[model samples]
Target chain A: MEQRRSFLKMIGLSVLGTIIGRAIIGREMLWLMLSKLTKVQAAEAPKQYGMVIDLRRCIGCHACSMACKLENNQPTGLVDGELETPNRRINWSIVLGREDGEQEKGKYPLLSKRFLPRTCMHCIDPPCTKVCPVDATYRRPEDGIVVVNYDRCIGCRYCMSACPYGARYFNWKKPDLGRPENPQVPVRPVGVVEKCTFCKHRIERGLEPACVETCLGRARIFGELSDPNSKVSKLIRERGAFRLLEDYDTKPSWYYLPW
Target chain B: MTNIEDVILNQLTKTTKRFYAFIGALLVMVAWGAFAWSIQLTRGLAVTGMNIPVYWGVYISNFVFLIGISHAGIAISAAVRLLRLELYRPLTRMAELLTIISLMLAAMNIVFDLGRPDRVLNMVFFADLSSPLVWDFISVSTYFILSTAYLFLGMREDLSRLADRLPGRRWLYKALSAGWSGSEQQRFGQERVLRWMAIIILPVMVSVHTTVAWIFGLQIAKPIWHESGLGPYFVTGAIVSGISMVTVIAWILRRLLGWGKFFTLEIFRGLGNFLRAVLLIYAYFMIAEQVTIRYGGESASLEVLEFYSTGAYAPYFWSFVILGTVIPFLILCIPRTRSIGGIVLASILVTVFMWVKRVIIIIPALMHPVLPPGIGMSTGIYAPTWVEWSILGGSYALGALLYTIFMKFFPIIDLEIGK
Candidate 1:
């Protein structure tokens, strides 16, 4: 009788404990949700670096891509006298070419080709920073430039999956640099993710990003987005520029002027 | 000695040539796997077939599948004890054993997938609370510890009983038993503790799988993976796969150990009925998922659906439907074919194809990224390398070795209870 009574008492206590525990956790989660909703307002940085690309002026010379590779000291895509597959190559910026009216099946005479230079958008609200299991990737609070701490990344690649633009690249193998690596950029070890940093090193030193500087047609423009007087702001306002995948609400700092 | 003990404990006292051969083969596979891992660590993830876009492949699928299998043991054991399902009492210990071994393997697969395994501790030291992976880490580890304690506590009486009989390992058993003397007071205390643990562990198990699903589901980047229904869908799939694994393992032990009396056909029949109902629920989830994706008509999701229905993954997707779901469901439904042999074959099919389903879920969605494949880039077709296959095979071999060694030391059939 006593054993049964104790068992019942124990069961009752456990039930009560569970209810109390759940209530506390529930309240904490509610508080967290509320806190996150309010924290978005606090993300307004003073000097928001941004880019404005003019598609009409782009010549598709691939100079920006080359310049980016040289500036970042990325892999050369050469292994044992063989060019590595394009998928295996680490490219931070590339110009994508497609027939503009192909989706509508426009007639050959009316159809026109276009080039879209793609890179990390450096969103004001970055999904990559949120999904990183460690704080290896984060947005710089002062300048609003998203960057990765390569030394701290565990190579889980959750950030890669979170980026909607397919902007992130994983170092599959030890990077083989055929030329003398630039002393300015750190040669990231294999296994961590890498992407365009808006040439943060160059920007910090008061110089344009390599891609912006080396564009053959001067299609790429760079300046402070936070300042209304900045060249990027004036171009965006005058040209009626648009961001990619605006539906995603990432608020990309990068913009493009249509041809 | 009672007839039950004589039959069940016979294998502990004796060794056979076949057993030695089996252990040898398993060790070879494990060694091969270790060698492959060493190569991967040195050469980097280049050894695998993974690249950009399809950044994850076989390793992640194996991790999910193994974790799915780990859920059945504790769930079934807890349900049996808590709900007074006496017919399932015989299967509890083996189910719990499977949970421990498979959970270990699942955790190992995560490490195997890591690019820098040496820096894994950074997940804890520099943890991000908002990340779903951290939630998965915490929940899975909590489940592991709780289940381990639950398994050990339940084995106390059996361990104490075996200590006196097995003179060679008397000290080991005595230490493990922790002076469990079968007193009324002790039994009452133990029962209360176990009951509480069962209640606590059930929620943790659900959270573990849900968090795993959230790792993909929360990513708005992938249209197919980002869905509100993913949490329940993953939980249902986990239960189905876990139950199938338990059925297969239980049948194998029944044959190998010659414990036909303990693992009766009636027990299998009950399990079959239970599995059939769960399988139906799982089938419902699959249909609901497909219907929602198709009807929503989101372009990215449509592309993923197209990839599964009529694209590169069509063969694998249909195979899972026919072999894993439909055929097994048909076999389990028919009264004549729901016998022990039929159940085992159906279970084997379900277990194998469920893994195929996981691969299909992970790889195809990745292959069809929202953005188009840019200039000069290949359309990201993934094929696992020999090293990956070898490691996968080695993980199973290691699991089998653990189970085999455990059977040698302990009573796998729970001799103290339901006698």
Candidate 2:
């Protein structure tokens, strides 16, 4: 009878404990949700760095992509002498040939082409940063640029799955730089994620990104979106630019001016 | 000695040639897997087949599948305890042991998948409250500890009974028994404790799989994986796969230990009925997930479905449907095929197919390529390398070796409780 009574008492205590525990966790979750809402609201201010791309001026050249490879010191091919596969290759910016998918009608020798140069949009509200377990990836408070600390990364690839744009790249093998390392850019080791930093190093030194500098058409524009006087702000306001996958509400810094 | 004690305790002393050979083969497989893992660690993830879009591959699938299989032991034990099902008492020990072993393997698979296994300690030092990976880490580890304690506590009575039989290990057994003299009060207290544990562990089991599902389901970026149904879907699938595993393992133990009296034909049929019901629910979840994806009119979802139906992963998807679910369901449903032998065969098929189903579930969704056509690669595929396959083989061998070694030391079937 005593044992049964103790068992019932224990059950009561456990039930109460679980309820109290759940209430605390529930309150914390509600607080987190509220804070996240406010954080999203705060992110809408125009104080962050951003970029604008003019598609009409992009002449289907691979200059930006080439410059990104050289600037970041990314591997050109795998160690086995074969060119890196498109899915596995680590490129900060990749140029997609318009001929692959954007073949429009009316092609009687008057063929026009348009290339889409893709890079990390540096989202103001980054899902990748939120999902990273170790805080290895985070959006900088000052600029809202999503950056990865390669040294702290455990290579779980959870961030890779969270990025909607497929912007993240995993270092599958030892990063075999085809050329000598650039002393300016920090060299990342193997077994970590890497992506475009919006030329944060150069930005700190008061210079434009390598891709923006080397663009043959001067199509890639980089500036502070927060400042109304900045060139990017004037371009976005005057030309009516649009961001990719606006439905996701990531608020990408990179905007496109349609042809 | 009583006939019950004789039958249960006799099997522990006999180490036959076949047992030695079986354990030897398992050791070889484990060695091969270790060698493969070393190569992976030394050469980076390049040794595996994983790439950018399909960043997660066979290792993650194995982790999910093994974890799913681990659920069977606890779910069964808890159900038996809660419902007062005397027929299942003999299975509790083996089931709990299976849970512990499989959970360890599941955790090991995560280590194998990591690009830098050395930095896993960072998860402990720098735990994030928001990340689902952290949730998974906490839930799985907690479940492991709780289940181990539960298993050990339940073993006290059996250990006490067998303490005097083995003179060399008597002290170990006595210590493990922990001063339980089998008085009325002790038995009463132990029963109460077991009952409470049964009540407690069921939700933990549910939470473990739900958190695992959240690791994928909460990712809004991945179309097929981002779904509300993932929690219940993973749990239901875990139960189905777990029951199938228990059925297969119980059958093997019945044959090996010659415990025909304890694990009768009726017990097998009872388990088969339970598996059939769980499989039906699992099939419903599959339909609900696919139908929701199809009706939602999301291009990414449609693209993933197309990949499963007619594209690269079509073969695996269809085989999972036919071999994993439909065939096993039919076998269990038919009266002629519901016998012990038929049930065992059906269970073997179900267990094997469940692993394949996990692979099918993981790969196609990943290969859908969410990146826009102008930016990233249009198509990506993953085929596991020999290193991955070898490691997979090694994990299975390790599981078998653990079970074999455990059987030698302890009583797999509790004669004191089960009549």
Candidate 3:
């Protein structure tokens, strides 16, 4: 038994040594790769556009989500063909109901309900883009918006696994646009990943996203975040906005002004 | 003329009516699975029960499981070479065949999991080297090629001996043997090559499973998969499940083919003891993995751990513990239950439960809500459809069929005439 313990001790030490050794080597390799990549990307400095949502003005009406679906040609019903369950539907702009503190404490309702509208954060170092084995998803250098090349996407769903925000959605089946199709956005084929593109098609046409344009409460704000004069930047400066899951280091373009 | 040759050849040349029936059943399954894949190809991934949050299910689970199973062969074969255990000589070729067949099935499982099988070529045309999936692809393919080469190289002496005796398959044997005349120089070259290949294979096998683990482990997005310990944890699981699988296969072959004299009690006993030690180590890893998540203050990992322990996944979690590890460990540990039959039974339990273990690993981590506690973003849970189940069953049958065909064509057990 004593001999077995010593043997196990030896093996553990060796394994620990190997892990530490590999980590050091791996760090060095990562540094070298980052250096080389930064030099190549430095040629074209891109504009970083972002959004800021002030929760104080939101009414939980889901107007932004509807506008997004109308603009993007997303399917109306659940892909599984379930009824009245909008949660399982292809929603590019999801409006979630949030509550603060303990629930069910005294019948008078201590907790307050808040509506949180979630769109693609369009992260600067997007996890989805980083893990796409086929480079189908990429962050455009012209603007900081992450986009998916539908033609190149093999739909391996590795990006879905890597995404912290759960923003990416797969085209599970052929899309059925309930309303008349919007001419601006191209309908994505089945078997490719689709997400909120910050309405890149509209952005290129010098128009704000449909969600921002159609917000009944005017809670959504969008502009060039890197520019100090932009509305998003002004809001961030005035309200001290924060990104969701910031600890993940995704550097999301979207921010929220908490009440 | 030799006793070894006569006995092995007799089994190789003959087959029962049951063998044909078994092959026929497997072929029908393969055809049905191919039809199911076509349906999936025409329709999208919605055909499967996968939805938001639970996007991966049985396909990915089976992929990881088969990859783990493949490790048994090369790991054992390489260990035998390193330790100079002549007792394992008879089992080496069978193990190598298992590795090759399982790997092929694992790759196919990946194809089944893909939303667009046609665009698979895009993985190569525009590859992202930083992605762990790319690392998985590169390592697994490299392992496959090396194992195939190693298997053939090890079989050269046997192939040469059988080339003249098997007159109908002479050309195939001759081509495979690579014109070996059994000279001393040729023998020396084979030894040197085999030794180097064995050395190379060991690390490659380790890296292959580690890379597969990294596909999940590198993701900080999911709390359950993003542990630094996952790499070693997966490797340990692979070795444990692999040895258990090999034990089952070896026992079945011994009983059915009447190769009991060649296999011997000592060989099964050695394998059983080795399996027991590996089980102990795996149990230690499982405990360490659980303790770190359960006791640690990381809320995200804690939520996942809680989910596994007492929430929706509790049934699979507890069953995996009792049947997969604990019971098997006890059975293999006790001298009374350490017989050949006992070991085979334990192996069967471990093998099935390891697969169940993988399904447990993939689902709960994914099902956990990505949003913070306050936000209610409920999504559907995964339940694999008939298409998935059919394809999974077909994949295992295909692997067994391949093994059976290979056994018929070649002398899987080494003669040990020259060695």
Candidate 4:
């Protein structure tokens, strides 16, 4: 009888301890969420924004690559070789990968490889922002554009790992310095993570991203798909294009079509 | 009395030499690994075998395996304390030690893969508090602390004994035990607190390994990793591999430290049953993952499934399935086949195979493209450079060295332990 009483007493104490610990953690989380709510309102722009990629005409020119580098100054190479290249630069925004459906240089040797000019898809259901413990990165409700607040970012790489798209990059070295410095993308510090923004700076200024503006072949498309009357909505409807990785349901803002 | 003094004097004299030699050996290997990492660090990631199609490789796989192995220590320690399983008494302290050492190394391996280890502190400062990785950091640390405390408490009465008797390091043990007073009331309090820690540690252990599975599973990149099954799979894998590690190490220690009477063939048989059950569970999950992917027939999922069953990963995959699962299960299931040496061999094999399976889980998914065809979203194939292997070697050596140092100071197989 005495042992039974003591066991019950122990259970009561443990339950009380756990509840107190949880209450403290819960309170801190609530405070963080509230502080984030009052700080910025990217939602003021519009909801349901997206992008469409024109697959056929992409010449792999890497102009989008240059624009991103000129803008953000991301690290030159993950691990650059000791030797030098003619450009002495590495491509961050531009990469050579097989088309989602094509094979090359074998029995069907003549089949052409397409240039994707890949960047962050900026999903409507952004997993990266959702998993950000510090509220350092968030999606603006007004336009549904995801953005990162660098000052608040603690380079834990949780965002880096959470991103399923492989879109995010870390500034392993110091952020690139001495770019012509378009204010579209901010240069990151060595420790914090970075990625291809949908150009929130350009969006705030009520303009398209510099890459969308500067596309020679005009392969990239950006606009508010929510406003069906918006140019992006019209183009998406007319051209029969789609967002990348739709099955995963990230609801990316970027779309591509093979021209 | 003179004979006892002579023995004590001899052990004391050997301490510094053994300590230096052990540390020197580990440091040399660490330096070698550091040099290799430097090469990979200096060269662009292009130096690796990775090209557009396969992104993750051996390094990431090893990371997952090591982290999984790290969990067994805590699991065993917690299980013993929670159920009051007296059979587990002899094993708990070593199990707790394994937990701390293995987990620290596992955490280090994750950081080692980062392009910038120098920026690691940012996770402490600027980490996304919401991300599972952040949760992983918190849970692993919590487990580390709890496991360490559980270890100390189990040995507290013993530490106090040493403090009272040993003159040279009376102060050290005194400090460690925190002036433990052995009133009957104190004994009761210690037991109560330990029971509490043991209960708390169970869910935390499950969360930590399952969170690792979530890291890849939640990612949309690899269809193989995207399944909900990964959590259960990882937790089971951790327990099985962890038990195997403890068994092998325990067997070895029994021979080396003259601790045969305590460890016993019966203890080995109990561990054998433990490994066999988990391995069968592991096999069931493996088949489930393959069947789901195969029957679903999504080209991407099929590709990963086919790759899992009979692709580039086939050799290692079969090796893992056979050596880690089938062979051990075969031996351990039959009582006649079960011997101390046989169980030890099986344990060692399971540990290595569990690591290989993790490598397969990590690398193959990166092999498949996530975006639409002709969109150029494919990852490149990557082979770990020599530097990665060196760091891995350094990590294992470091883990063993930590265990060695602890053994040198305290009698790990002391009669009162696990009691």
TM-score winner: 1
Error of 3 at B7 (Å): 1.5
Off by over 4 Å in 3: A1-45, A78-88, A98-112, B372-377, B417-419
Estimate, for each residue in B85-107, the C-alpha lDDT of model 2 and write its tens digit.
98888888899999999999999
Using TM-score as the measure, what is the rank order of every candidate, best first?
1, 2, 3, 4
In terms of lDDT, the poorest run of 10 residues in model 2 chain B is B369-378
Expressed as tens digits, the lDDT of each residue in B321-355 for candidate 3 is 99988898899889999888988999999999999
- The recovered share of true contacts, given per candidate in order, is 0.69, 0.63, 0.66, 0.23
DockQ of all predictions against the true structure, Cα-based: 0.58, 0.53, 0.41, 0.27
Please state the Cα-based DockQ of model 4 relative to the true two-chain complex: 0.27
Q: State residue B169's C-alpha deviation in candidate 4, in Å.
A: 1.3
Q: Per-residue alpha-carbon lDDT of model 4 for A157-249, expressed as tens digits?
A: 556555656666544344445435555466665445567667777777888876777788887778777888987788778888776667767
Candidate 1 lDDT over B1-419, as tens digits, reads 36777666777878899999999999999999999989889888988888878989899999999999998999999998889898889999999999999999999999999988999999999988778898899999999999999999999998998898888889999999999999999998999899989988999999989988998998889989989888888888898899999999999999998778888999888877777888889889889888888898888998988898778888998999999989999999998998899998989999999999999889888987777767778776899999999989999899999999999888898885435
Give me the iRMSD of candidate 3, please.
Answer: 3.4
Sorted into a CAPRI-style docking class, model 4 comes out as acceptable
> Cα RMSD for candidate 2?
2.8
Deviation (Å) of A29 in candidate 2: 9.7
Per-candidate TM equals 0.94, 0.94, 0.91, 0.83
Top lDDT hit: 1
lDDT of 1 by residue, A213-254 (tens): 999899999999999998999999999999988888788999
The residue-by-residue lDDT of candidate 4 on B15-127, one tens digit each, is 66646886889878877877766765665333434433343456567767777777777677778777777776677777778888888887877666654556567667775
